[model samples]
Target: MNQKQLVVRHRLRELMVAHDIPSVQELSRRTGIYYATLLNFYHNKFNTFNNRTIATLCEFFDCRIDELIYLDKKELCGA
Candidate 1:
């Protein structure tokens, strides 16, 4: 049987651009989230997602959960 893995990707940068947010610092100030935490999400360097963070982003951006994060399936090396 073939194996697959689902990876979650963040759209923070795109959302920021669409919303006319200038910088991560500005976003952090606006959203009341830490710069480092938002930066991690912006660069997709996170392994786990926090419910509060996701809710905060969705509320701040007026976007859906799907819009904030999406899934990509990749084939495993061995099936």
Candidate 2:
């Protein structure tokens, strides 16, 4: 199997919905991920997450690597 190419978008809102995280504001407090940045991330206004940020999200959600990231066709074009 081949590894999928990932887009540089963030999906914090989707994660919140799947995990029942109440609100971005609350999640921000809980994750210490910065309210405005997290909001921008969720809204697709921000692109890309830093290694440390990804690590923080994973650590907070107790999720494995695959659970945190995904690939879409647009991301595969250059790969």
The candidate maximizing lDDT is 1
lDDT of 2 at 76: 39
Q: State the lDDT of candidate 2 residue by residue for 1-79, as single tens digits.
A: 3446556544566677888999989888998888887777667775656787778888888886567666554523343
Off by over 4 Å in 1: 1-3, 76-79
Candidate 2 TM-score to native: 0.68
Give lDDT: candidate 2, residue 64.
67
Worst 10 residues of 1 by lDDT: 70-79
Model 2 misplacement above 4 A: 1-11, 75-79
Q: Give the TM-score of candidate 1.
A: 0.85
lDDT by residue for model 1 over 9-75, one digit each (tens)? 7788899999999999999999899999988888878988889999999999999999989999978
Clashes of each: 0, 0
